[model samples]
Target: MTSIGGAEMVDWNLAVATATRLVRPGPEVGRDEARAIVAELREHARSAEEHVRGYTRMFGEDADGAAAPHDTPVLVVDRPGWVRANVAGFRAVLTPLLEKMQERRSALPGGAVLGAVGGKVTGVELGMLLSFLATRVLGQYETFAPPSFDLPAGTSAGRLLLVAPNIVHVERELDVDPHDFRLWVCLHEETHRTQFTAVPWLRDHLESEIHAFLAETDVDPSTLLERLHEAGQSMTGGRASGEDGEGSAAESRSLVEVVQTPAQREILGRLTAVMSLLEGHADYVMDGVGPEVVPSVGEIREKFQQRRAKGAGRLDQALRRLLGLDAKLRQYRDGERFVRHVVDRVGMAGFNRVWTSPNTLPTKVEIAKPADWIARVHGDAGN
Candidate 1:
């Protein structure tokens, strides 16, 4: 990979190439079949956006202060294309942090060569991770446009990305109605778009939290690798693998230790709460749209969940645990419960006040106990 300005931190091209190489070829669906699938998806894309936004309007406030723009064109891609796109997205997100880490590395011995090796390792690991993840993510609502993501010309700032092959795979495997499942997936992804666009502050808010997280931490390459290893186990109760270095010690520390400082806790806690809300709200809205809109809603929820819980090979399971994907799996249940509980006690209108300001967002404890959040926000009875 070529270095930029002689100080490249992530070697993004290497990451993309690595991911593309590692990605397994999909089942041999024919070109005509594939083309038909894309055509149908593309046709539904516009209506999916309208239906999703329409439902979102019924449930939450406009996040962007204006009508959420409809200009973000939907693009369909194969699994490898999805991997490259996400590698691009992660580059945009991770570059700043990598640069900060690079600055900290300048003080160490064996700077340039060490940095090159570090960049290579990081790029490879990132590629490996994205290759695995690309198959898993159904759709993504990309809020910020990074030039490197190479989004198509004339598309809007906010866009929805769909993995066409994955969509086809899931529909056939689940034996669910293809049209219904495709629309269902679109509804969920579009809700994500509406959430960020509705609350215009959300994108910047998440970016700022990321920036703070980067500023507060410093790590060498080996330690950073070790930490990524630990993040995989974080969802479970396993200890992160590490030895005596300061960064290693941080990795070895439990989630509590990592969030020990007020500043770190504030940042992590806010991120957790916000993600939970966004996810939960989207799940809630997806369901709220109901059986009328998606007749297989109940079945899709049930078998799709079973599909989610289906075990993989031993190594894949290990990777999922290490990735903290188990924790991500939990967010759906936890977030939806919080949203359901809140709306149950106060009704949707009162719950809408949560969007009024960041202060009203549920804390981790509050998510577990809706009555407490209700009382705090509305002086209703405490849990």
Candidate 2:
């Protein structure tokens, strides 16, 4: 890897090899196949590079003649260590749970589709596949311009970050087994990409809500400064605020945290509700698809529930902490129940009709009170 202005460029050949290996776990690409894929990827990379360059020429520099973009540079990686770490972490933590989830499919409304894909994958290869899948899903939305994954330069867009390091850290901590982890993560992230793509309005809705929340957020600089000063003093004196005087600095820090404003809270609530619905629907789809495709569907579903019960990362909690929007646990249950109810009452065809329009889709209230939703659908059908 060569560094330019603190950004490292990744070798595309290595990336393709890693990705190919992950997608087709046991066999290595033959010399001819490797050459062909690398050639194709190079062409793809060239196009991506050109796109990024054009974007830079138009929007890269600010009025001050300095690079104004805040996003990390998009570099091609042939063998990024972080990518491997992420794949490994996801496998370690998520695979066993998925296996367990497969066992309990009967109890779950839609647990039949666990481990739906049965191919072997190396960690690096998995990341490449995920990145590719994410691109496809995000491409469905007209508003979302795909990032230049092949480029070696950053863009002005800060919202969509390819924070490979952060991703690796989170995946590692989650500690799920790799194969199952990759499947779930692929489904999860791909679901997000699909939802944003399928619901064009939702992209703006989420972005606007996030901006609105961020705009209203007020951090107490004074409090932050005081805390820093106190920490410095304690470090020098070896005596903090506690009676023991040997306690850690955290002990002396204020327990109070930043509180959300009413407006922020409202936005957060709406965001969480939508996210929960999205996740729940994905879970439903997975459950539906898994049993038919994967042999271990029942075991995986059981494992997934056990992981959740053991205080494993809740989709809502992680999203809330990351975006300041909490997807309530009940929201998933409600959303899943709603989907199942809709499917049961009207069949998949009727359920699909609701997605014909955002307005037709069930509201937060409808999600909570599914009977009203059923009645509305029936009444509409009668009309």
Model number with the top lDDT: 1
Report clash pairs, candidate 1: 62-198, 63-198, 63-199, 64-197, 64-198, 232-322, 232-323
**Candidate 1's residue-wise lDDT over 135-188, tens digit each?**
777888777656534455544356678888788778888999888888888777
Residue 145, candidate 2: alpha-carbon lDDT: 33
lDDT tens readout by residue for model 2, 97-190: 3333233332444322211211212223334433332221211111223333522223222122232223233334455442343343333333
What is candidate 1's local distance difference test score? 0.70
Worst 10 residues of 2 by lDDT: 135-144
Tell me the spans in candidate 1 whose CA falls farther than 4 Å from its real position: 1-7, 58-69, 148-157, 227-262, 380-383
Each prediction's whole-model lDDT (CA): 0.70, 0.42
In candidate 2, position 227 carries an lDDT of 41
TM-score of each model, in listed order: 0.83, 0.45
